[model samples]
Structure formats: structure tokens, C-alpha cells
Target: MPVPWPSGSICEAGVEQGIASKSRLVDVVLDESIGRSTPDVEHERAVAIFDLIEENRFCPVGDEGGGPYRLRLSLAESRLVFQVSREDGAAVVTHILSLTPFRRIVKDYFLICESYYQAIRSATPSQIEAIDMGRRGLHNEGSQTLMDRLAGKVEVDFDTARRLFTLICVLHWRG
Candidate 1:
């Protein structure tokens, strides 16, 4: 099935051209952090992120980690917050982004993506068929606004960003 933008193709392309893509990074980290509780909690966090994405493609958008700054991820139409920072020698993603009343950029964009994602995932067999019918149908439609919102929300290091985007594409294309 056709996947969403910035999914597999974008990530693959990004890797070739040196861009920040999500899927690539997630795979590397998860591969490195699979079984044991190693010295790098960041790698573990990456695995957890993969788990979360697999379980639910939608998450709230907000300051998930809480401190002066906010770290977050966008899936579907929701923004998942992460208590992230570059310290020691790894990138840390802590906490799931929550639903807050405030209108933060990360959160808002995530919500949009989450909405589209939910609509796609919740589609029945008939609905899926309908969406697949034509270019303007659900499957063929694209969300530029969502993509615009997604801009900069994925600011993790190169590898992590690529991996995350890759996973997002997988979720979007899941049948």
C-alpha cells in the first residue's frame, strides 16, 4: 500500500543525502538497546519509542519532559512530548507528550497528524476501499498543513530523526 510522506521513501532518500530522518535512527538505537540495560539509557528510550509507535500511532502534544524546554515527537495528528536532552553522550527521550490546554506548535501539529492518522487507521474495509478509489480520495490525499506543523518538531540528532520518520511511514502504510 502507498505510505505517507516522509515515510520509507523520504527516509531512504534522506539517508542518502544526509538529512534527519526518524526510522533509521530508531532502528539503530533499538538494535543496540534490545535486551540488556546497558550504559546508554538513551538507546533504551529509543526502543521505548518504537514500542509506543507500534502500539499507538497517536499521542498527545505538549511538553512531555517538563523543565524549561520541551522535547516532543509527532505521530499522526498528535504530538508526543519527550523529556529529551543531549547530555553525557546520548540523546534522552523521557515521558510521553500529554494533552495540554495550551496551543504549542509541536502539540498543535501533532494533533493534526494524529487526527489524520486516526482517520486512516480506524477506516473500515469499505472505507479503505473508498479512500483507495481515486486520487482525491482519502488514501491519495496529503496533509501539507500537518507536514508544515511537523517541521522542526523532529529535531533529534540525524540518526534518531531518520529512524523516527521511518517508523511513522510504516505506521501510515500499515494495512
Candidate 2:
């Protein structure tokens, strides 16, 4: 005879069975309070959201909630706010990160990105590649900084942090 399982048991069993625990952003909303951004910035935002949703690992530290979270990103009063929620629309955690720590890296990343874009249009192939390398290095540094800042609040892989960092830069542009 089969044993009867309690409510929510199946879900718990799935976790124990090594079924991947889903932890990701199902939806992202950028607050309109920051005002409109340039088309190029808008494109970067779209791409980052698309790439993040495609593959990411996001688990809120010290929270027992299941994944597929919804995120609302905004900047207010020199702070970056991460409004997180569950798939069912329940409030999860709201993390506010100061912008001071990210200012230098974000500014440098923007500068290198501009150089890389301009190089692609007029510079020689080798020159463009060299600029692109600097751009990538800056991007990595920004991503690592983001990961460090979010250390006790959320856990995300390097690529996830990179994409999130891009979005943060977009917010910073008009913030």
C-alpha cells in the first residue's frame, strides 16, 4: 500500500530528490521615477533582462521562500532599491544598496563602453579588439563589485551579476 503524503510533501520531496531548485527573476520592472533613458541605454536594459531571464541563479540569503521571484529595480536618493517578491505576488525582501561603492566602476565601465562602440565604427580590427578587452575587464570589475555588495542579501553567479550590473548602470545614468 502506498503511504499518504502530507500537503506540500511532494514539493519537498522534489527538492530532496535533487530536482533543481528554481531561483530566478520571472519578471523585472524598472521604476519610471528615474525618467527616460537614451535609446542605447534602453537597448542595454532590454538585453540584460532577456539574458538574465534566460539563465540565472538568484536565491535570497536567509530566506526560505521558493524561487521564480519578481524584481522591481529603482534608484532613489542615491540608493539602488531592489524590490523582490514571490511568484504569487507576496512581498519577499527589499534590499537598498548605496550607490557610493559603485560610482567609480560604473563611470569607468560607461567610458570604456563608449570607446568600444566608437572603435567598432572607425578603428582598425586590432584596435577595436583592444578596446573591447578593456570594456570587458571593466564590466567584470563592476560585476564583481555588485556581487560583493549583494553578498549577504542575494546569491548570483558571475554572469548574472554582470547583467544586473548593466541594468544598474542604466539606472545610474538618469539617477
Candidate 3:
């Protein structure tokens, strides 16, 4: 028999003790504290949020929180804050990660991204592809780092971590 969920709780498949069935973020909001972003940054943010909402796997580790979740990403006091909440607007978990670990990778990723964007304008196809490859590599590294940092705090797939990393970069841009 299916377990009865409390009012405003979301129930998914396989809702056993520590497992929350497949989950995704239904709404993602960037904190206004980051200030306005450039058009390029804004576009990237939009795409990441869209892709994450369209497909993702996220569950709070060791918590009975259900999905879909509402997430707010922001930088506060030099830390990256992931404010997660239930669909009904009740808070679930708030994970504040240190930015020090991400500093170098994020810096490199931005540098490569700048090069990639510039390459798109004047570089040869081969050159552009090379820069793009580097950009992707850095992106992947950042995502992996994120997953590692979130380990035991929250559980997410690689693709979901990648998208979240992008948003983190966006936040880092202004910080």
C-alpha cells in the first residue's frame, strides 16, 4: 500500500525511508542580491534554469523531503547558498557551501568561456572548437567538484550538477 503523505507533501515513486523517487526542480530563482547580469549571462542563466526544470534528479540526502523542489541560488557572505523548499513553499534545506574551493575552477571556466565567445567571432572553426572543448572540460570539472562538495548533503546526477554549476558561475560573476 502507498504511504499517506502529509498535507502539501509531494509523493513520488519508491518513497522508502531514505530514497525520494526521481525528483527535479520545478522553479528556480536567482537571488536579486547578485544584481543585474549582462545579456550573455542572463541568457545562460535562462537556459540553465530551463534545462534543469525540464530534466533533473535532486533529493536532499537523509531527509524525507519530497519533490518537485523549489530552489533559490545566491551568494551571501562569500558563500554559495542553495535554498531548497517544498512545492508548497515550506523550507526543506539550506546548503551553504564555501566559495574558496570553487574559486580557481570558476576563474578558469570564465576565462575559457570568454575566449570561446571571442573565438566564435573571429577564430577559425578549428580554433573555435579547441576553445569550446576547453570550455566544456572546465565546465565538467566544475560540475564534478560541485557533486563532490554536495555529497552527503544532497544527491544529484551529473547533468543536474552541471546545470547547477552554471548557475553558480553566474552568481560568482557578480561576487
Against the true structure, whose TM-score is highest?
A: 2
Q: What is the TM-score (0 to 1) of candidate 3? A: 0.81
Superposition error at 127 for model 1 (Å): 8.3
Sort all candidates by TM-score, best to worst.
2, 3, 1
RMSD of 2: 7.6
**TM-score preference between candidates 1 and 3, better one:** 3
Question: lDDT score of model 1?
Answer: 0.35
Candidate 3 clashes: the total is 0
lDDT by residue (tens digit), candidate 1, 1-175? 2132344432334435543222222222222112234445445455556654332212112323222222344332343334343323244455443323223433443445455556587878776555445322221122222333344443222233333433333322212
Task: Give TM per candidate.
Answer: 0.25, 0.83, 0.81
**Per-residue C-alpha lDDT of model 3 across residues 53-114, encoded as one tens digit per residue:** 87777777655556778998887888888999988889989999998988999999988988
Worst window of 10 by summed lDDT in candidate 3: 1-10
Tell me the spans in candidate 2 whose CA falls farther than 4 Å from its real position: 1-21
The positional error of residue 96 in candidate 3, measured at the CA in angstroms, is 0.5
Q: Each prediction's Cα lDDT score?
A: 0.35, 0.76, 0.78
